[model samples]
Every structure is written in structure tokens, then in C-alpha cells.
Target chain A: MTHPFGPATRLALVVLAAASLAACASTKPAGPVAPRGPAEPEAPYRPPSQPGPVTQEQAPGVTPGSVQDFVINAGELVYFDLDSYTLRADAKPVLDAQANWLRRWSAVRVRIEGNCDERGTREYNFALGARRSNAVKEYLVSRGIPASRIDTISYGKERPLDPGSNEEAWARNRNARTAITEGAR
Target chain B: MFRTKNLFSVLLAALATLLAAAPIAARADIVVNVDQGVTQPLPIAIPAFGGSSVGGQVSQVVTADLQRSGLFRPLDPNTFVQKRIDVNLQPQFDQWKQISAQALVTGQVTNDGDGRLRVDFRLWDVYAGEQLLGLQFTTTPENWRRLAHKIADAVYEKLTGEKGYFDTRVVFVAESGTKAKRIRRLAIMDQDGANPSYLTDGSYMVFTPRFSSNSQEITFMALRPTGASIYLLNIETGRQEALGHYPGMVFAPRFSPDGRKVAFSVEKAGNSDIYVMDLGSHATSRVTTDPAIDTSPSFSPDGSQMVFNSDRSGSPQIYVMNADGSGAHRISGGGGRYTAPVWSPDGKLIAFTKQEGGQFHIGVMNADGSGERILTSSYLDEGPTWAPNSRVIMFFRDSAGGGPRLWTVDVTGRVTAQAPYPLSASDPAWSPLLN
Candidate 1:
């Protein structure tokens, strides 16, 4: 069969496509620019030597035994399957790292925050989230962290990490996060 | 339910005498049988009241109230052959019969010249040509809407042999913002979605606000990043107090039928169970000891039995047990996940949210789990609350990628409509009819 469109319509389509391409091209930055320092420094700045790989304790800006350090060196979140409190296989490593971090910072008191996706009802999800946070707390306690140093709260589906209504967002939302509620530097 | 039925029969017997003079063949009374699976709406005509602007507005409100019930079809004024009506005088039955109106409502509003408005209305059975009800209400001029609702209630009760849900209020959680950071506040409004006011300032998230039997108090759960708390709030006085501290998260609070106690769920160390607390004594009792999730406890109208949600059978399902937590047995059967089971005020049916086939549904079933009926199905429809009359159920429906809005469905599933509120809302709790 012949082309479905006449010459004028085909010409208009080509023009529209070209206009969309121009719009897309405009979104990209033209080039990279050098960073600018502050106009004035409180004290004369000294250029330090290029630093080698440093431990989290010696890292710049991140204080040792702090909330930021725990978040950076050890993952704070572990995800669960939908409508489940069973920790995923991949989540085991994260919780293991968290357990080790908590053991090192023995004085840090943490709260395990449990959450769920939007698929469940409000009251039921609250119970489900409690189960999830408890799952994390139990795992940590099993790995040598004292139970007394930890607290748990279930946000249910009230607090969501991802707002999208798709499976990926729901996966991210069903999680338990270890929050440093006290004893952080 | 038995008390209301007795009252209805008594009213019917009294009205029978008024029809005694008519021929026996024409003595059939007008009644709407609401128990059937399908019902044809009774056609009624409500003309503008005779006196002032408030008169017309009152008539409009009364008309709207009856229309929204899905039990009455208010005829258009253009179809009214009788142009004028007087509250004290009889209507022309021939004109009403010609337009197929089974019931006629006539009323007049008078300003007493002392800042009070006097309104009187009469409900007539057009077929029998007899007055079924005549009542007058006197109130401040600004309270015309409530007066109109009272009149609507009178008409509904006279025709259907059941109490009316008009003149009541609904307490719900008004939600705004994105799902990730939603702001939910306790909100209340007239049953028709008028005179809405926020009871809480949307600072922390609130959920599942349930009205007490008296309609003056509500118990709701407020969730914060730190923890969760259940609060009992007196709506009339704006006085609120936390339901005391528990060892764990406390949520899903609901008042007993008599409004003397509150039942809620407390979660500790990943396990959740139901508990009840007496408001007067402040004594708390554990209702369920199941290791699995046991939440959302709703009491039967007589306060003898409790229906709640549980997952002990490996999936979320509804269960019924004694008020003291004995003889708990699963009441929900089938393949769906049933949650949020609320016992109807009439104590005949249980409403719930069922999730099956990747779709959520609002449904009701007999208290024994027999005669299951799904009223609505959508991407998400949850948290079903029964109207005071138990004929209608209000719930929230959340669209994919959108916020939730309140919706109502009658028991027969024959009529469904979105609530008039224009914001994201959920967890609707309908109050009992105002005294």
C-alpha cells in the first residue's frame, strides 16, 4: 500500500520530529565549568596533599562513631518482600554490616524503623511493619548486638521511601532502617 | 435493631387507625422493603417551602439528603403538576398520582421575628391520600440545614421503617501531599459534606478516626516519626487526651457500641494483638493472645461479640470472637485477603476490604460469613464504615498514582457515589443519627 499520509502531513511530521530533537538537545549542558572557591576565606587556606584511601573514622567531614559514619560505612536499610517480614537474602549482608557497626559503637542506641508499601490497609500494614522491624532487630541481636540498646517502631505504610505506584517503588518502600536515636557523635 | 423494628411497628399501628375510614380494598399502606437484593427507588416530590429564601434552601437540602440515600428518587420540579402547596393543607393527590409520585413532602418556613425560624413539614402518602407524619422545628436562622436534615430523617423513617442517616456527621482523615510525605489531619463535616472543619492541624499524620456512639467524641491514631499514639478527642469541646502509653505502638482505636471502652491494637517486638481499655476506670485488658497479627477489632452493636482481622490462618482474614476473647474462629472464607472488618451498627452484617486478583474490593457478608457480597471493586478500595442505618457503607478508593477519595455504596450494591468532599480523604467513620 502507498504511504498512509499525504506529502503535507508527512512534511509536518518531519518538522515535529526535528523540533522534539532540538528540545532534547537543549536539555544537555553546553560544557563543564571549573568550580569557584569562596570570594574570601576566614583564615588563609593551605593546600593539603592529595589524600590516600582513608578509613571512615579518618574521612574528611564524617565524624567517627556518628550517624553519618554509620550510614556511609554500613548500610542503614534492609528491604523485605511484599506483605512479608522475612528479610531478603541480599538484605542479610546489609544487616550483618549493620550488626558489626553497632558492635563497634557499643554506646550508640538505635531505633529500627519498619515500613511497608501502600498496597496494604492502614491498620494491617502497621502490624506488618512491626514484624519487619522486629525481624531486623532480631537479626542484629542474634549477631551479638544487645537487645537493650535497640528500639523498634513500625511506620506501617505511613512513611514511604518511594512515592511511585509501581513495583520498583513498592520494593524500595518495604524496608527497615536503623536510625541512631541517641549516643551519636 | 429489634428496638427500631418495634418502634416502626408501633408507628404503623397508630397510622392504621387514620386509614380505618377508607375502604378495606384501598387501605394498603406505602412501605419500602429495603431487605431485598434489588429495590426500585421510591419516587417522591418535595416542593419549595412556602415562606422565604431559607424555605427554598431548606427544601433543596431535604431533597438532596433523600436523593443521596439511593432509596428515594426526588422528582424534578418541572414535572410537578401541582404548582402550589401549603404545609397545613392537604395536597392534590390527583396531581401527584399523575406524575407517579408515591410520596409527597410539603413544608413551610416562617421567621418568628425574634431571630428564630419556625419550620414545619408533613410527609404524605400520595396513594393513600393520608398524612403519615407532621412535625415542626424551631431553631436559629443559621441552623436551617440541620432542620432540613431532621425533616428528611422523619420522612425516611416514615417510609422505609428504618432510622435515617441524615442529620449525622462523618469523621475522616483528610490527606494531602505526595504519598511519600503525606499530611493527614482529622477532619469532620456534616453527612452531606457541608460545614467541613479540620479537627487537627495536619502536623503529624492521623489515621482511622472513629466516632463514638454519642457522636460527640472520636478516637484516632496519630503516627509520628518517633512513634504512634491513639487519642480520644471530644469533638464538641476540642478536648483530647492520649489513650495512655503502652509498651509498644498503639493504633487502630475504635470505641465500643456503648462508647464506654476503646479497643485497639498494640504491637510489641513485631507481634500485634488486640486490647480493650475502659474509659471510666482506665483499666486495660488484653483481648487476643494470638502470636499472629490481630488488629482492627470492632464490637457488635450489643457489645457482646467482637469481629477483628487476623492472619493466623497464614493469610489475612476476618475472625469473630467473644468480647472477652474466647472461642475465636475465622469468619472469612475464600481466596481473598480480608482486612479491616467493621461490624455494622445494626449487628447483622460485617463490612470489609478484600484483596484478590490484584484488585481491592469493598464487600459485606452476613455475620457468619455467609451470603458474601462484593459492593465495589477498584485498584484500591479499603476501610469500609457503615452508615448509622446500616443500609449504606462509606469507604475510601485510591487510584493508582493518585490520592484516596471517599465513596459510598448501598448494601445492595445498586447505588454508588463519590462523597461531596473535594480533597484526598480516607478512613470515613459515620456517626449515629443526631438526637
Candidate 2:
């Protein structure tokens, strides 16, 4: 196949390679060459680094409208009290950021997964998880996200984030997570 | 999947022989009083059945069944002074009495010459020197296990004067994977933990599989990341379908006594309410309008009332209301939080799981919520299901830092044992007596 890069772009790559070599050489010690043992293996090859700032849309891995972007930029998890579906005060800011993120990506559809600790019975925890997820969904709706764009599910005590049986693990397991389902890059 | 044939001719012959051979009363005097809080297990002898190897297997199954019930202590075959007793002939009452065996079970398995097996069993009152029960069952060779359970049921009923729960099945959630990303599939097995198979793949999560009165259909909840839905599955046909479309999360599905309606919960905007759907008409009716959480609805045997779990009383407690959702009132009157109330098949009691002081217990109360009794206690024990006879309750127990396992307890709290299967299991629902 023919080369895809033009002469000008190739020149730009050569300049970037020279700058990287110069930087590496400056880090070496300025002393006489010592007697070397056997020949050492060459260092692993790395691509030349671009100097300009990359926009969110042009990020290397996570694109702007991707699920990773939604998960990393805005928080996806909110914790609840034991046997209580009422969102904690600290959960408000995280959910607010989620709502703002959803607004910016209006086409994205999300599913709220409610989970519980192993302290409660199966059916009751199922109901409690449903309540927690709906609590998150309603808050999102109140923050201008459309209700139609969101769905909810309750994993009950079946899916515990922390398998430990202690109070700290239980506190961590009893939470709701937002998952971007559709219309993401 | 085998057909059972009742050998009436053989039964009549056995009955005639027993009636003519003994002068004592045929009824067994040594009865098991299951209602008493404490009673000694009756010592019975069950030697290997005569005939082929299948006979030995059947006898073993019967022995296990009676032994697991905690009502009978089967004497070791080595302890039997009179071995090799023929089913067609009477046992020596003197030799049996020497070993202190109150009752004896003798059986024979023979090929019926057409690739089928015939089983003949006789239950003897050793002290009275008379046969209490005799019957014959014929089925395919592969169906010997079921025939063995049938024999055990007959013996149990003849001795205790109550229906037997041996000829049944249990549907449960087979749990695998870690606690955070557990994969739950619907599974079932014989009451004695035989013929186990998974009905659903472990692609999504499933919970609370419940059997209908017919024993062939089940209703359970399947949860996915997007939403939750209730499904009806036919165990025989391997046919499954979603119940219907709802605007909210639907779960906790259970069938009515007649198997014509399903009662479940629907949650919208963080509030859950109970609803009943008629399977024939496809019409749904809202049963509870309370603003509080109302779920886990179990119907009475007569189908006139429902027992459900609710938080309307400020905490999770058992509640009973009319079938049409009238005259609602709280039934549980204890300190701990009570939930997952299931009415017994006989309509006499309501079983529930109680959480208190960092411990969970399986308990039962009268229909009016009086005469409360705790049967089993552990780190976590929940979801008690009633055997068809309503004499036994099966529930799941989760130990500290361990997965859940199935366990059973008699109503009197006299017997508690782990299920035969060793896998992690939960949410067991016992089926009605198989037809």
C-alpha cells in the first residue's frame, strides 16, 4: 500500500522524533564511556507525542459521547442508608453532576441499577432497591432530564458490590449505579 | 418423565394375604405425633428389598426420605436379626421384636417383562404382628426413584395420619459467581434433591421462583440492567413468556391457589403497590392503594384472603387483607421486622422471616398472627416455602462470609437439616403434590 502521510506531515513527525531524542540524550550522564558488558537490548519503541492540548472529543481512549466519558466525567454511583431508600445528602452532588452530563448528551439513554446489602430479606431488599433507583430517577427528572430517557432496575441483595459481611461493606453495597445503555459513541 | 401404573391386582393379592395371616389389628399402634414439641423418633427397620439391584436403590431412597423427615430412625441393615425377608411372605415378628424395631418395611422390585419395573412394598406393624399397608407400583426402570418416593409417602401417610410431602419438587435460584456480579438461574429438582436441572441460562439474574398448583408452571422475576420483568415458565414445555409490559419495575410474582391469577408488586417513582392479574382474562386489578411499600403477596388456600409484607405499619411487618383488597390490617405483633409472609398450603399458618438484633429467623404464626413460633435461627435465613402437606418448611440460610444453601425444618422445629444438594442456592419454592 502507498504511504498515507504527505511530505509535510512526515517532516513534522521527523521534527518531533528529533526533539524526543534530544530530551532523552539530555537526561544521560555526561561522563566517559565505561567498559560495557554484553550488548543490552534496545528500549521498546514509543510513538511520538503531540504537543497541543487535546479536546474532550479528541481524547485518546474515551470519546465525549461514550459510556466511559459519562462514567469518568460524571459520577455513576450514589450510596443509601441501611434499609432506607432516601438519598444521602452527599449523594445529591453526584446525582446533580449526572443530570448535567445527561443534558449535555441528550440522546443518551440510561438505566439506574439499585442494589442492597445482604442484611435484608430477598423480597424486601428488592423493593428497597427499586425505591432507591426510582429516587435517583426522580431526582434526575427534577433536574431537567426526561423521564422517558431513563429506566430502572433493582438487583436487591442479589448483587452486592462488597461481598464482605461487615457494616462497612454493607454500607458500600447499598447503593445505586447509573449505566448508559444506548445512544452512546 | 415416566408413567406410573398402579398394580391393583397385586395390591389385592397382598392385602388378602395380610388379612388372612394376622389376627391382630392391622393399624399401627406406634404413630408419630408430629405436633408435640418433643417426641422420640420411631425406630423402624428397612432392609434391602428383594429382587434386582434397582430394589436396593429404591429401598435406600425410601430410607433416606423417612430418615430426613426426623420422624423415623431407620435401623441399620446390619442390626436386623431377620434379614432377607421376602415381600410375598410375612416377616418373623419375634425376630423383629428382638431388635426393638417398632415397624418394618419390606419390598421387592421385579422386571415386568416389557422393559418396565414393578415395585411391591408392605409396611408392617411388628409389635402387632400385622401388615398396616401394602401396595404395588409399576413404571419404567428410570422411574424407580419416583416410585421409591411414592412408597415413602404412602408409609408416612399411613403412620402419621397426615398427607405426605415426598412426591413433590422444589424450584430455587441456583446462584453462582461472586457477590457483586452474581449470576442467578432458575433451577429445580426432586424433593429428595434428584434430577436437578437449570431452567434458565445465567445470562441475567433471576429470583423467587414459585410453583403453581399444577406443579408444571412457575412464575419468577428476571432482572436486567435496563429493567425488571415478571415471567411465566412451563417446566414441562420449556416455554417462557413475559407477563406483560409495565411502566415500572415489576417483581415478586406468585401464583394463586387455583393457578389462574398472579399477584405481584409494581414500583413507580419509588413506591411499590400490590397488583393481581387474572391469567385467563389478562385483566389486572390494583389490590392495595396504600402509599407505603406493599409487596410479597401470598394467597390463602381458599383464595379469599392474602398475606403480604408491607411497611405501612412504620416498619416491615406481615399484613392480611381481603382478596379484593378490603379490610386490611397488620398481623405481626413482634419486636423484629417481619417480611416474606407465605401462607401454608393447608391455610392454617403463615410463615415469615424475622430480622432482629442482627440475626435472622424462620418463624410461623397462626392465621390471625397469634401463637407465634420461631423454628430456625441463623446469620441469615429467609423465604420459607411450605410443602404440599404444609407439615414442612424449606428455606435458605446464608452463613457469615459464605454463600447461601437450602435448608428444611419441620413445623414443630423438631427436625432441621441441610438440603442434599451442596451448591449455593436460595429462594426455594416447593411445588404442590405432583399429579
Candidate 3:
């Protein structure tokens, strides 16, 4: 059998093989460097200790340095409209930036904390939180990051970042934040 | 012949001794005239269950339990003329009666050397002026809330002539994050929704948390980012192990009455079925083979039968089956959509969420599906959990335009409002009687 292969094809194949080999080499590096302390000590980057891909992107309306501070200090808060569980367009650029940073580091994982405003009962809030977290997972998956790298938990309004009783607080309370763990490859 | 005659005499002597002791055992069966006809909340006084090295905080929890039941009108501790809580110290009945208190609860607490707290309490009938029951147990100081609930159970059983529910704990999913990328955490709390602590952070989706029959472990559906599976979590140690690694989603889990088995719903493709697994062996068996959505399985107190919500009969309805998944029968008669069936602790009634005519209501019926009586109604009411006494239910009702709120009702359908939280809350699961 005769095969038609151009130089570009050969070059692309070379790049693909190199990428896979790089991935394989990076897989085992998590053990020794798994303890890289996050930038912020109080809310240190305790990434998922498991192996997976990472990516980070700056979200729209979120200043580049601002998201880093959000992840480090007071975690990022995602807001939602009434009766809706999908991420807003404004949230994409922020999540994409996080996904980009997540992609660069291997062996590090993120904790997707789901929360809802005090609008529903405890159990319903529980279900609602699940829906929100699942949305984040699905988005990260769409961004080419492996699901194993991300873990989710819903606070269900039990832990509020803001304890005020106004629309701004409610809007701020309805969100999910990502915590980058320490072990980065 | 002489030896046989001697053996017969010895047997006769033992029988005579047993006959002499029979009346003594009978005398210990304390009797009190309790009127079942009255459905009013019973008025009782629970003195600060004393014995705290620092401040007696657990006593306040006990006070809260009695106050929430709507059955007992807790006397104000501030107005008490005299308060004595030492277990060895006798309560002044005349002083308690002056406040119109019908029942009194008192306890002593001591921190054990091994980081455990010891609590001993007694429920006294002030009207009868006698100790009705005495209870003692040891737990960590952190478990003082549980101790208060245990005290409430003792007082409830003594006065209401029914089981007390304060000893129970609730397991449910906890949430945080945004609607898009939210995190769902597993959490457990006291029956009153206090002392809520997270078991798992939202690294995954957890649903339908049900306590084990022994109240030590919990079974719920956890969807890992990689795959969907159910998980069994221990409440005390926070250890979680995944359940059946199947090709699809497994959810709506409940423990068998004996706490030895777990029953849950597994969905493959578009079809859902009920399956039971032996917790010890991790062996699973299909309970329902139909293509319909058969979920929400609850076991009878004897562990012989199970009641679950199924859609095989067209709309969602209640169904019962044997432990081995044989002899399936429908217990919910013609009605609206019914989900979340919880068998009564007494093995007499099944409480469930009934949706009739667009609105949701909490209803209870006999095991046979007869005599269905709705206990609660609201624009959006779901997740009906029964108290240990089988006389009351605690559920979340979403008020119109406002957030979801928690409410309780008697078996006869009288509603008593509970203190609402600032945020939305739902899924009220009453814990087992504590002590």
C-alpha cells in the first residue's frame, strides 16, 4: 500500500507524538512537587492530588490579577439569575482563564464549590447547587480539561461569603468558586 | 427411679421460683393514663439540663427541641422559682406546678477524661411527681447537641405517650458556587437543621442522603466528574466509599431497615430501575425490572418489606415489595404525582410528597395505601420526613415569591410554623429518637 504524506503531515505527526510524550513524562512528576504551597497561605492551593490536565483563561469583566486574588483570598463568586442554573456569558471569560491556568499545571485539581442564595429550602437548595456545580464541570470539560482534575461541593447557602440582606449580597451569594490545589506539575 | 424422682423435684422448685417472680416483673410496667383523643401540644418544662463545665449550652438545645415540637409548651427558665438539675437532687414538684408545668426534664453532664462528654438525664412527670425514665450516655463535647436531642426524646416519650424524634439526624446535599459551575457538598445536621457540617466539598454531585437504620452511615448518590455512582458515607468519621461502578447514574438511595443493605435507583440509557446491594458483600440485585422510573425505595421497620415511588402505574405512585424483590404491589390509589415515600418508624404509616392539582402536599397513608390523609399543603412542598413518634412530620414548604421554608404538622393535619431561616432551605428529614 502506498501512502501520501506531505512534510506538513510529518511535522504535525512529530508535534503530536512530542505532545503525548510530554504528557507521559509529566504524569509522574506530581509525587515530589505535590506540596507546592499556594500563593495564599490561608486559602492555599490544595489542588486535587490526582493526575489530569489543567488550563486557565481570564474571564470577561474579571481583571487578570483580580481572579488570582479571588482564587487566593476570598474565592471567586459566580452569580445566577432567577430559576436559571446555566453560567452567564460574562462568567465564561473568567472560567476560561481559570481553565487555562488549570491546563498548564498537571497533578493539581480545583474544588468547585456550589452555592445558592437563601431562596429555596435546604434540600431544594441542595439539588440546585448540584445543578450549578454540574454546569461548571460541563464547561471545564468543554474546555478540554479532564473531569478527574475537578471536584465539586455545594454549600447550599450554609456558608455565605456575604452575610448581608440585600440584592447585591444575594447576587454575590449565588456563586461557585474554584480553589487551585498546591501540587502543580 | 430415685434419680428421676429427684430431677422432677428440682424442676418443680425452679418453676415455683419463676412463678413467685412473675408479678415483680409485671409491676415494673409503669402505667399512666394518656388520652389519645387530645391532639393539643403538651406543656412541659425542661430545666437547663445542667452539668456544663463552662456554660450549659446543651440545656438550651433541649429547651429548643421541646419548644419546636408544638406538643410541649416549654416553661420559661427565667420564671422558674427554683431549679434543681443534679440527677441525685430531687426536683421540687410544688415549685414546678406553680408554673403549670406538666412534665420536667433534668440532666447532669461531666466531661470524661478521654475527650468524651457524659450526660445523664431523667424525664419526670410533674403531675405524677415521679421519674418516668432515666437515660445515660457518653459522647464528645461536640456532640452535646445530640445529647440535648436525646433528652428531648426521653421527655417526649414520657409525656406524649409516643416515641420522641429529637434523637435523629438529617443527611442531605450541601451546595455553593454559581448556577453554571456550582459545587454540591454532602452535609449532615441535627434534625432541627442545626450544627450542619459538610462531609464532602462540591467536587461532585450528591443527592438523596438517607441515614442507615443504625444511624451511623449514610447512603446517597454522588456523581464524580469522571463517572456517576452512589456513595456510602459514615457520619462519625466522614469516610466515604463509592457504590456500584456502573455505566450510568445511580441515585435516590435509602438504607434497608436493618442497615445491612442499601436500595437505590440506577439509570442506564433513559430507563431507571431499583437495585439493592448488600453493604457487607457489595452484591447487588435488581428490585424492579420495569422500564419505568422506579426510585425512592424505603424499607419497613422489620426489614421484610420496602415501599418506593414508581411511575409504572402511569403517574408517580407508591409501591411495596418484599426484601428479595418479589410480590410487588401498588399501595397508592388513584391520585396525583407522589414521590419520596418514607415508611413510618412504627410500621403503620407511609409519609410521602403528594402533588395534586398543581400544588404539592405532604400526605400519609396506611401501608396498604388506604386512608390517605394529607398533612401539609403549599405552593411548593416536598420532602416529608416523619418524627420518631409517627405523629408529626417536618418538611420544607416554599412560600409564594419567598424562599423555601421549613414547617411541621401533626398527623391529623394541623400546621405549626417553625422558625424560618434567612435563606432558602428545603428537604427536612427528621432524625430518629436520640437516646
Candidate 4:
């Protein structure tokens, strides 16, 4: 594509942005996340990350930027069916994609949070949530991620991505989400 | 139940004749048939205790306590046939009988001018022309409601053969905010929903505050950013200590009947197992080593056994085991899914939550696992707690499209009422009757 702005114009805009960077957060505010619904498994999903004949060299500490990029672009969540922890066909690909991304940037430590819909008993849902998180961890380990790199917590039905009580919303709520906890120095 | 009462009848009959011939020692027995399926609530009359504002408040509290039990109906004050201007005057039995009140309650209140309250009340059988119970309590003004509960308990025990549960308290997780960023705080209140107070700030997410059977303490699961773990809190002293030092997540905790041990589930490598921690020694022992999820461990009343929910059979089912964790047996046969199995205090029944066809129910089965009867059904009804008497179950009912709120159902399966809470609440733990 041809240059949209002239050099002089770009320089002027850059100077203005640098001047306002410190106060940008005060000028702009973030809004609530939009509603999400029952999600179908992603297509062209990669299987769990696996090691080759020769072990791959481990990556270093995760960079915050790359971790954020993985969460935003590579997908950090996998959904589950009602009261179930066994991953679905669609879920495999999404998890496969997650495993591939984690393998490529192996230094990052993550905490897997398993959550459930607001239906089962809180205590029991907690166990179910753990199973979901552990299921994801097992898949990632099968793909070559070090088991030590991943920790897990079950939020049970206590936390939900979608507050709606409908099945569509519950589907969104029943998910395992990964948060980048430690990045390389 | 009636046979136990019959044991006292023979002695009472002899005493009744002696008392009748000797003009009595200042009391009379008031008999009211109180048993399961006693459909008609006994009609009772209560007049103001000498026209004081405190008396009016006490009477109102007492009336609500009785009515909430689904056993006694307090006559409307506006329809009272007699004036209550004199606290010392005797109640005219015929006047109460005229209003068809089977029982009469009259009381007096004294402020004592030192911020202490003195409450006296008497239960009279109007039709029988006899007084059943008389009791007096002196307490601080701030504990006026407790006095009312004590009076109600006295009246309830005299009429019903069972000990009263009115003088009780409940601990629960009071919730607020939305589904995404929900806030939960530990809360406590009188069993009748009065004197509600917050025990914890909403900073940490807390679930399942279960009362220790032997004291003013509770064991609950607290979720923090670091990890999910179990905590033992002295509700009275505000002392909190971590109950487990496990590196993995620990949740779904309950106190042993003696309160010396706490049974909880610990999740490691995605597998949840049951563990018992002896509070005195702080030593933990694994109860279940299975790979399946085993949680919601409730101690049997006698501490000899425990009932918990497990999915070893590929589905969550109620299982019973010795307190030391041997001899696992499935007790929930008539099920779709069963979870949260709590042993009733009387040891005769085990209460649990069952889910089938997308609906949840609070149900009970005999101790041996036969005769499963579903109690209340709704979009979600889980975590059934037994009243100290085991005659009632309190649980949280989530409306199909709304948040959770506290609800209660008696064993009769007929009386279900919302236990009022200012905010959304769940996982209620009813305390044992206060001494």
C-alpha cells in the first residue's frame, strides 16, 4: 500500500502521541466485556503440543507483550459441556492451538482456572472445575509442555464469564482459562 | 416418638393426682399433640406485656418466631378479645377459649433502668384452663431478640415433644454484584433472619461456611489469588487460621461431630480426594485415595461414620464410609446425579441434592440407602442442611434466571419458605441449638 501519511505529518503525530502517553489512561476508560455465547470448537485446531525425536530447547522467561499476544491472538480459553470435563472435538483444536503457542514461547508459567456454570452444588462444581483444568493441563503435557510450567485452580461456579442463566450463557461460563503468571527476566 | 413421651406419662399421671389434691406447686401441664403431619397449626393468643413499647416489640418477635416454625398461628393482635394493661393479672382462660385459641401466651417486660432487659412469659392451655410453661430471662437490651427466642423456645418445647430450634443462628455466604465480578462475604444471623451481621469483608471469595458442631467456630473454603484453601475461623474471636498446608487446592470442608477434626477435599494433579485434619494435633490424614472426585464430607451425628459424594461410579453418588474412611458403599441408587450428602443429626436419614432431567432437588434417603424421597424441586436446589432436630432442611434455591437465595423445607415436604436475606445468599449452615 502507498504511504497514507507524509513523513512530516507522521512526525507531527508521533510527537503529539509521545506528549500525551503519560496521561492517556486518565483520558480514556475501558468498558465491560461484551456478552459471549455458546462457542463451537475452532477449526484447523492443532493437537496437543508434542516433543520430537530430539527434545526441543526450552524457551526462556515469557515476555509480557508476547504473553498478552498469546492470550489475545492465540486463544487462552477452552469451553466444556454441562457437568463434563472430557474435551470435545472442537475443544481439541483450540487446546492444540494453545499448546502450539505455549511450546513456541515455553518460558511462560500459567495458572489454569477451571470454572463452571451456576447449576451444580458449589462444592461439587469445584471438583468438576478442577477436573476441567486438569484435563487441559494433561493435554498440554501430552504435547510437550513441562508439567511444572502449569498450575491449576478451580473457581467452580463461583466465577462466570457470562452472567446469563440461559444455556448459551452457561456454555460460555463453563470454560478453562489460562493466565500468564511468570515471565522470563 | 410417642412411645418416648409415654414413659413420662405414668409418672405425670401420679403427680397430676397428687398436685390436684395438694392444690399444686405453682404449675400445670399443658398438653398439645405435636407430631409429623399435624396439619393444623395450634391457635395461640398473645397480648401486649403491660403497654410498653419494648413489650410490643418482644411480642411481635415471638409471634413471628412461632409462626415461622409452621406449628403455631399467632392470633392477630387487632382481634385480641382482652386488654393486656395488667402484666401481673391472670389470663381469663374462658376469654381466650372464646376466641378459639388453644394456647395463650402472656408476658411482661422490665427495662431495669440499667440497659438490662427482664422478660417473663407463660404458656397457658386456654381450653384446658392450665399453664404449661413459665420462664424469665434477664439480658442486655441489645439481646432483646434473644430473650424473645428463648421465650418462644420455651413455649415450643412445652407444646411439642422436640427441643426448639428457634433459639438458633445460621452462617452463610452473602453474595452481591454480577456473575463476572461477584463478591461474597461471610454472614451470620438469627435463624429467624434478625440481627444479620457480616463476618468477613468482601475482599476474598468464600464458600460453604459450615459450623463446627461443638463450638462458635466454622470451617470454610476461602479462594484467594494465591490458591484455594480451607480455613478455620473463630466466629466470636475473629481468629482465622489456615486449616491445611497443602500445596494444591483444598475445598469443600466440614467439621467432625466432635469438632476435633475437619474433613475436606484436596485436589492434586486434577484428582480430588478426601482428607481429615485433626484440629488438636494439626496432623492431616487422607481418607480417600481414589482418583475420582470425592467431596462434601459430612460427619454422621455420632462421629462413627461419614457420608460423602463421589463419582467413582462415573457419576456423582452418595457414599458412606466409616469415619476413618474405610468401607465405601453407594447409597444414592435412585438417581441421575447426587451430590452434597449431609448426615442428619438424628442419624436416621441422609439429606442430599439430586439432579435429573436438568432439574435439581433436595432429597432424603434412609440411612441404609432405601426409601429416597425428593423434597423440593426447582431449577437449582442444592446444599440441604439439617436443622439440629433434623426435622427441617435449609438450602439455597437459585431461580431459573436469577441469583441464589436461602430457602427452607421441613421433612413433611409441605412447608417451604424463603429464609429472607437482604442480599443473595447460599451454602447456609444452621448452627446447633444454643445452650
Question: Could you report the DockQ of all the candidates, in the order they appear?
Answer: 0.32, 0.38, 0.03, 0.30
Candidate 4 chain A weakest ten by summed lDDT:
A1-10
Index of the highest-TM-score prediction: 2
lDDT by residue (tens digit), candidate 2, A148-173: 99988888887776779999999988
- Number of clashing residue pairs, candidate 1: 0
* Cα lDDT tens digits for candidate 2, B365-420: 99999999999999999999999988999999999788999999999987899988
Q: Estimate the TM-score of every prediction.
A: 0.85, 0.88, 0.61, 0.84
lDDT of 1 at B418: 97
> Where does candidate 3 stray beyond 4 Å?
A1-185, B1-39, B49-56, B83-92, B106-123, B128-143, B177-182, B224-227, B399-407, B419-435
Please identify which of the two predictions, 1 or 2, would achieve the higher DockQ against the true structure.
Answer: 2
What ranges in model 1 sit over 4 Å off?
A1-61, B1-28, B37-39
Clashing residue pairs, backbone N/CA/C < 3 A, model 1: none
Candidate 3: C-alpha lDDT: 0.65
Clashes by residue pair, model 2:
none
Descending-TM-score candidate ranking = 2, 1, 4, 3
Docking class of 1: acceptable
lDDT, candidate 4, at B194:
77
Score residue B19 of candidate 3 by CA lDDT. Answer: 15
Badly placed stretches (over 4 Å) of model 2 are A1-26, A32-65, B1-26
Q: Evaluate residue B340 in candidate 4 and report its C-alpha lDDT on the 0 to 100 scale.
A: 94
Candidate closest to the true structure, highest DockQ:
2
Better of 1 and 4 by TM-score: 1
